[model samples]
Target: MKLQTLRLSLALGLASALLAFPTAAHAQPAEDHAPTLAALKALQANAGPGAGVHAGDGSTSWTLSTGTGTVNQNRPIQPDERFRAGSQTKTFVAVAVLKLVEQGAFSLDEPIGGLLPGVVTGNGYDDTAITVRHLLQHTSGIPTNGLPLPQAGPDGTYTLAALVKDGLRFAPAAAPGAAFHYSNTNYEILGLLIEKVTGLPVYEAVTTGVIGPLGLTRTSFPAAGDRAVPEPAVHGYRGARIGGFYFWLDGTVYEPSNFYASGAVISTLKDLTAFYRALIGGEVLTPASLAELERTVQPGAPGVEYGLGITAYALSCGGKAWGHNGAVPGYFTQTLVTKDGRHASVVTNAHLVTNVPSAQMMKVLDTALCESRG
Candidate 1:
């Protein structure tokens, strides 16, 4: 089936699920404790028809998407909807690498050259200068070299190695460990390294070690040939200014293999939240490794720190939240988890538009959800 048709089908499914909820149910007191569900529903309601929210703590999880059959031209958004996670894939790769570290595959300080020879593109520093830690922490100073690949057509799959080769034109920005420059190439190489060390594909390693163990069945590494579509997947749209008129481009599906380890995973909010909780709660990595992941570097951004694959943001709520914010061509997603693993994750398919209703919806949901924690 065409990608757009698939998206329409998923959206319709979500809308149907949402409309199944009775609107005439007993009106609970607004002041009642545990307002996460109600707050999420309110956010969905405000987003108009075809909007949904899935929220939970350590105990229970709930999903709610509201609307009638195939609302909004058969493109209703769903709760378990899968979207391009973008840079959030970095965390998954980092976790996989950390698992290898814990299994005595390599030390954090071990040089990347020893793991994957000739993967580094430029040469201000030798392979000896770059370590596994350097790549994970974004201190490798590798220049970001992401090239937009055209979507799959009648041609076959494009391998990750081809994507890396396409990115090799750029030189390193600084000496390894000298500064923090966000580079998709860093994780791309890390993905290659994971494949090298494990003797399995990067996708296999992540699925077997991280996603499978955490029970995140909603998540997977999508590739060109794979027909395994995530249920309730949202169709991503991009609004572009062409000749002073704004036009929306529909049915733009990103090639996950092009993103590779940098931005390939597709997941639901519930699954993403569960993964964050697992990682932050020390269930995924050792306490020492987790500490290393949380350690701040002096690359010089106020309240911004790099820990392995995660980004640490000091929240106004007097705690540190770690995760990544991601923007693909047609999606924007943010996943934030406290040091203790409590978190708020939001994902939207509306992209490159001036007025983003998703952002407003997220803000409302976050304020209400966080206030409930108080």
Candidate 2:
């Protein structure tokens, strides 16, 4: 039940990326994506056998992919292809909750005990002390047991309640709002809160609150009990070299309930880029709510700040991009958009575990954003 998403090595694999850059950041025109594509291609050794990039703004956009979508065949991963977006779903879920806040469904400072009642008991936790803001900001003092304990029901689907219960089994990581502790339990609780208020499933509530409003055409959630990836997907793979032979495990059909509200979003590069752009551009939330989301704090990560569900990454090239990185089992996705409207989303059909050069992925994002003129 362990996922290889953000539990990644930040070790920079900069040699290949530094040598591969073909253009200065100032030379890239608004419409040119070739440079970004080149950076993505250079990461094939780590991100293969499937990788894609979808970037640009509302005026112009570009899509490119290298490597095969299948294990044996040479079917290339293409643009607008669907893949699991992992924890990127958190930003969407956070927006959904904030939209509910705008609608006065509940306040961000409301205690969980008041909102859901009786759900936040025991485990040395105080529901009243844990606010919605704490959960969103990962300061809820919840342990990180949510991912390790994936207790699915008989149908292989995980209930948000079950996920939260497993998370509560462990004692508080710290006193409420004491430290930045990224845990799936906080989001699972938010998912439950979303359900309680809207009387709709998490997926339905998010669609009505965020996706539909944003016109994310190809983004969707897999229906309950369904494990099939939608058509034209970048099939995720996990590979290992044993002795002299190499093997790959296709995780494209990974269970939708595996991460529930904490992850488990099926999306495309185009859809994700557009969503992040809108989010960073202030189209998704009210000015007040968006301000609340951007009230960030250092999460003990270098050049990165944790906000509500999104993160702000300080680019080495200067400036910051707001978005989230996502990974399930085999799929990994990174999306970042500047406040100035430039955005980039890079997705690969492989977990960033093992010796995979995750820093190359970061380089792709930096190069894409830095190279953009708009």
Candidate 3:
């Protein structure tokens, strides 16, 4: 990262830390919030505590948190406690790239191989055949690269370039633009591509471009060697080997640097809701850019499709909630918003083990957006 860019990022994050969101200003008239609260508590019960949430419609917003902060279970999980957003970082990367696109820094249809040169090659991967859109939509055909098990390498395997190179051990999943294969290699490549185009670290680009502009005071990317979660965090957990047996280990101490642009973002429930609301509401993106981000491709799931780093979850009540879900060892989280502005963000304290069931989580979000409709 450039010294100038680092200074700008720190300045923006510090200055915005004191800004407040207009949570209750938009009034949608009173509605029963009991169901929302109930849904969150149910998530806590199954997800191993820290079921923190921030949800709202166009005119109303609210937050709720259940259970205690960590293993000792001494204090309640605060609604604003920061947690890893895992793969959701892709959404931020997509936004940054799109902003650059608006400024003529990128062309979605253009080959990113030309931008990053030899960064993505071998293992049947050819950067020349992959376009920016292919990367964003997970159609680059890069095999799904797995992260080191938290027990093996808590902080993650390595950096974006390292991960891209590591991904070549397996052959390509398919031909570029062949299908939506859901590869982190796609976004890892995006991080490198962004750096090449802007001459700034991907984190710096996202901070100045998205976090700062959105006034997401509580949202940030973890810096290198910053293994400790910032204070007042809802600690995450996963299984770890101990005495020849497995036990719950606090996963919060791992390095976020290894996640790079793929899943290093740390944010609170309120920030999660706010960021997605702003992005989906057209406050952070130009109309054409937003449209490009929302263009969907089937990812082999029922009632679900992916756009540029965004996922559309089918609602039980008839509309789709768009956003992303992230799982980074100890933390499993999701943030979604409808086109009409109804939205929810939830984070469970554990993942990989004693974690929230994917279906249960989907229902938790779906109910948050659907119950009122019924």
Candidate 4:
């Protein structure tokens, strides 16, 4: 069977199994169940237009759109809207590296220096000591370039090497397996290493090896200054409070090159779901590599857990899921899938904020996805 057909068959089989066995009679109250499509739509409406939800089990899916505005002040968000997957792009990079490992091109424990000479950050720590495993697990002790949000300008055209060098300025905070300090620099370095080893640009390597195999035509690593927003993309926003006054700011179109492999891919809900289904279904990496990818290295804070390049969580409703969440300057997004890849993909676009609402919305969406397994 073709790969896509095989994946759908596996998903259907799993869904059939899950449906065949009903949950315990007294597990939880029906009133406290996950949100329905209507409920999710109402919640997004409350949050504001441009806010939306996409949920689907292997058998069926739904996209709930609410709010209004051109995704780029020019186009409307529709059923097929695409958006930057943001840090969720890390999962793609991680899978790519793992595939290379499976092919005998590299090893997880191999030092990164040999792969990309003159690219490893040179500081007190031995550059040769950091392994590909450390990069995937976010335990390399690499500090980010301190520039959390990139300002658009000529300066925005900085290269991946510049970003890695900026991160190297700071000494490693802890020993290689110590703890997790999320840093874009890790994946940026990984991207460079992929390019060095494959003799292809990061984008080309990922597209040929992963995206094409998964049939995800809607996803791509766009170039810098590409203002052509994907069709039906949602507009992202930012909110803040200053001197007791609350305000919302419009987010600019994300420059994919600015983030590179760390967080730059643009994809729609359908394509994103397709990619994860293929990944967890064992189409991208070897069985051993997939096991490594799903192994948790460090515990993410409340409501999340960190694996090699993914996040796992036990929903409040019940059951476990794997996937990642992402945020850029003007947008925030969450993607989740069941351990068996049978659950839905939950994505929401919100005005960025450091507040409780975003967190609450995530919880709602997660619970909804988990409980909707039936």
Candidate 5:
């Protein structure tokens, strides 16, 4: 955290100086983005030791990476390296559900209780009161299981039903559609709905319905028993938590089942950027569905709002970007697509104590998209 805090100071200074310019005329030069990348690499080196950025508008694009994949290995982060997408997986799940809605297979306003019966009922949670739209919007009042990843061990695993049962042990956070509460349980339920309606595993449903159609060949959802990320993947690390002390913990490989539908896809920045642009550009979802995806309500996090799986962030620079950001133990990722199709995607191998992307990391995203606006 000390390292990241210092990096934040340097990054802000760099951002201030860079933004001072009038944003070089459109199509000026590819090197015009070098300063943004320099600031990003500096932040990455100090924050997580490894990171990459994929940025550009339709006319110009930049792919860059900084720091090493492994600590002290001198193996630099590659622009094409794969890593866990974390909760960003939600966008894919949401898109899949929305596709079903478009095909007349599911209705957003329909109560999940009617679709799954007694499966979602228990511990004071009334599934009958929660609708598919509520689940996607995180207005279903569902509480997270509240279990941290490390507690689940390296081989963490759980069935969707089991996770839901554990989550139900706590009463619903709010009445149905009462207010916004971001809950991993919400997406897990959507995963079940997909399974129920399509009669397929959540992974297969997402692959066939979302990933395949987009031709994201490098992206994949690992099975519960799988612990190894495919080759050319970046190794992730975290600050070790021992009795009141912190040390470096290598988080390169671990069962992804603990993340499940909430955060279990492996992908590169390239594929992520493409997916986000298509989603925000209305290539995958219908106008009605896209509207549902962009319609947002404050989720109690400052400057952040939640939509059906998608998130809208008001950039510090000016203008807003639509997409979701995610974090697992060893990775933090974000994809932001502007209204005019300018986009940026970021991936970091180091996660903070809070598991949230650092301000400096976010600044990089902000600058990349903001700089590309003109």
Candidate 6:
């Protein structure tokens, strides 16, 4: 399957990696305990793949990595190894835009036509009709760049203008603010906005504005054409469904430049969990901004309803956790942070396959969050 199409499934809540609830109660003792280890082990053992799950409660953290780094091998997955964070980059971009908003540089309701005139008009896309808020909320009606397999290598150069034009070739998905339709193109426009406003590339802006200030030393935004993840990274696998069955193939070297500000960030569980806590815990945004960041569109779904840069999920155990989950071709990550400050992150090496650590993994994540309650 194409990566953007699969990612769109994630946007529509079809392939939401953040499980709301699970039935089996496999609770382990909390004191000096690692509740996710056994579940993760079982997950890898049963699925024939490696996985990494991490949970933190602001003060303490635990990680469990099982299976092999490569297929048909015994090399254990590293607890700190990085993976392509996919659309999680949206959260970073959202935070940057919020910072710009907080600085009085732009208003959420500002129309795109005012921000970038003549840049977004093409193939039925009305740049003047969409707003920055519409872009952040995925209600901009922009369509995704329908690349079957992105032809860009890690070193290839492609402009954001080119990507926006690529997306414009397709008809608009819906009218502005008509309904939620997640498109990577929305963030691509935002990336261009950042560059236009700040005169820095999107990656440089995020690095200086978000990653560096947060002290996320292990996280990185790879330069264009830098297909290789930092050393000590786990190999990513491709799971293709064929004739009602699935097969696995190696896909670790997949290039990320094509995703750009939409989904190109790479991070480890530790860094990713820290980012979730910091983001949802009110560190990166003002109280008013955080409230706006979490303002929901639905009553019961809570975080399931999309917000500015985050998704608020109504935890099955009562109370809501704010987070966003991301999926690329070879990796899928579910990162959740409860309002009470519990954070959980799960990462896998394979993509779009049957049983990509679904319920079993959610059970582990829930137990981790529940343990933080007491």
- In candidate 5, which residue pairs get closer than 3 Å at backbone N, Cα or C atoms, i.e. clash? none
What ranges in model 3 sit over 4 Å off? Answer: 1-32, 149-157, 239-247, 354-356, 372-374
User: For candidate 5, what is the TM-score?
Assistant: 0.86
TM-score of each: 0.77, 0.88, 0.85, 0.80, 0.86, 0.83
lDDT of 3 at 344: 83
In the range 107-147, model 5's lDDT, one tens digit per residue, is 99999989999977877778788999999998999866677
Task: Show the colliding residue pairs in model 2.
Answer: none
For residues 236-272, could you state the per-residue lDDT of candidate 4 as single tens digits? 5444333423234444475576677888887776777
- Residue 170 miss distance in model 5 (angstroms): 1.5
Arranged by TM-score with the best first, the candidates are: 2, 5, 3, 6, 4, 1
Per-candidate local distance difference test: 0.65, 0.78, 0.75, 0.66, 0.78, 0.73
Estimate, for each residue in 1-374, the C-alpha lDDT of model 3 and write its tens digit. 23354345445554332221112111122554666667766665566435666677787776666655565445556657888889889999999989888999769998987888877776677778899999999998887876552222444445667766766666888898988788777887888888887888778888988898888888888765667778779888654222423234466877776677888999887888888888888988889999999999999989999999999988888978899999877788998998888888878777754334777677778877775352
Q: Which candidate achieves the best lDDT against the true structure?
A: 2
Order of the predicted models by lDDT, top scorer first: 2, 5, 3, 6, 4, 1
Cα displacement (angstroms), candidate 6, residue 105, comes to 1.8
Q: Residue 303 in model 5: shift from native, Å?
A: 3.2
Q: Which predicted model would earn the best TM-score?
A: 2
What is the alpha-carbon lDDT of model 6 when measured against the actual structure?
Answer: 0.73
Question: Candidate 2, overall lDDT?
Answer: 0.78
lDDT of 1 by residue, 1-374 (tens): 33464456555554332222213111123333344445445443433223444444455444444331132354444556676777889999998988888899999899987777776644455788889899888888777775454433466556666666666566778888888888887887888888888888888888898889888888997755563335577655453333423223443465566677888788877778788878898888899778887776754766667788888766545656677867665666767766543566765453453444544554534543355353
> For model 6, where is the 10-residue window of minimal lDDT?
19-28
> For model 5, what is the C-alpha lDDT against the true structure?
0.78
Selected candidate, larger lDDT, 3 vs 5: 5
